[model samples]
Target: DTAVSQTPKYLVTQMGNDKSIKCEQNLGHDTMYWYKQDSKKFLKIMFSYNNKELIINETVPNRFSPKSPDKAHLNLHINSLELGDSAVYFCASSRHRAAGVNEKLFFGSGTQLSVL
Candidate 1:
């Protein structure tokens, strides 16, 4: 069974279109995050939510938004999608414990977004 899962693994749309991606985790974690990976393979966090409360916003573009309905779910929405927005979006979760030696991110499969 997948510990984390996201819908629309692949998305292709024209610029100016709007799209959304959904994610769900079963790891019983209290913190969920949204990350974006560019074609260069640079992964950067966009948002994080703990117990359905927004905790971290990584200064992402205003067009990008993240919403968490609950601790185990995080959804991303992009309005007026642009070509620069094409990238793989990953949903992740963690226990949000104090920094430790084994701290890590549990990421979902990922959703590849393509804007043309």
Candidate 2:
């Protein structure tokens, strides 16, 4: 009964490697967001997609790119993974078009990425 789902709950990779995390939502939301939680448990927005269009892109590294195939899916691909990139990546969605800021977002259980 998960509204949002992400693959590979645990990811272990080497430094300078590349990896991808896939996300999907079934709530028919208009906006999807990617967030990263660092070691200190601080969460920061990385990217956002509204109806498969890029809307908000924070000052993330160029090696990190987000691709949304449709309104239901958002994928994050990271290249040249660094030690600082080790964190928990979360996928969340909200009905930005309908509820504005009042809508609560649904977030997937994050993918824990560890760089060796």
Candidate 3:
């Protein structure tokens, strides 16, 4: 019984390759998000989707795109992967759409993406 799942927990690849990280939630949540944590452990919200509609797009590079086929899943697709993009990509979810501000995020173990 996985509450949230993200594939390729460790991704190592050469630069300029296109890669995608998949995510899924079985917690019956209405909102899902993607977060990136750098080597310094500073986490930043990348994108968020509610009911398959994008609600937040942070100051991320155009190479990064998020897709949600349904409310339970949100996947991250990265084109022209670069060294700067190497970070721990986390998939998170909340019970309510507006509950993020107050509620703690339920995060996946994370996809440690490494661009060589």
Candidate 4:
């Protein structure tokens, strides 16, 4: 049993193609998030959802969209993937916060996308 799992750890593709990364969490958490780690190793939150309701949008490109079927799964869909889009995508989950302060986040290994 995995706490969180993502497929295709390495993704290599040309520009303008569309790709989707799937993520699932076994933890019975109500909050899930997506993070992008750039070449410089800067981790930034891309999006977050609580109980299927979006809670955060950090000005990411429209090409990147997150879909959460339930509280345990959040998938990312990228349209017109570009070279600049190359990065490591991480999926994370946390228990619902009491008064908006969540507990430690559990993260998936990551999906590295390479655009050429």
Candidate 3 lDDT tens digits, 1-116: 87999998999999999999999999998999999999999999999999999999999999999999999999999999999999999999998888646776899999999999
Q: Which candidate would rank higher by lDDT, 1 or 2? A: 2
Candidate 3, residue 48: CA error in Å?
0.5
Residue pairs in candidate 2 whose N, alpha carbon or C atoms collide under 3 angstroms: none
The residue pairs that clash in candidate 1, if any, are none
How many clashes in candidate 1? 0
**Which is the leading candidate under TM-score?**
3
**Candidate 2 segments exceeding 4 Å error:** 97-101
Cα-based TM-score, every candidate: 0.94, 0.95, 0.95, 0.94
RMSD of each: 1.2, 1.3, 1.4, 1.6
How many residue pairs clash in each candidate at the backbone level? 0, 0, 0, 0
lDDT of 2 at 103: 96
Residue ranges of candidate 3 with Cα displaced over 4 Å: 100-102
Hey, what RMSD does candidate 4 come out at?
1.6
Clashing pairs in 4: none
Q: Per-residue error at 35 for model 4, in Å?
A: 0.4
Off by over 4 Å in 4: 97-102
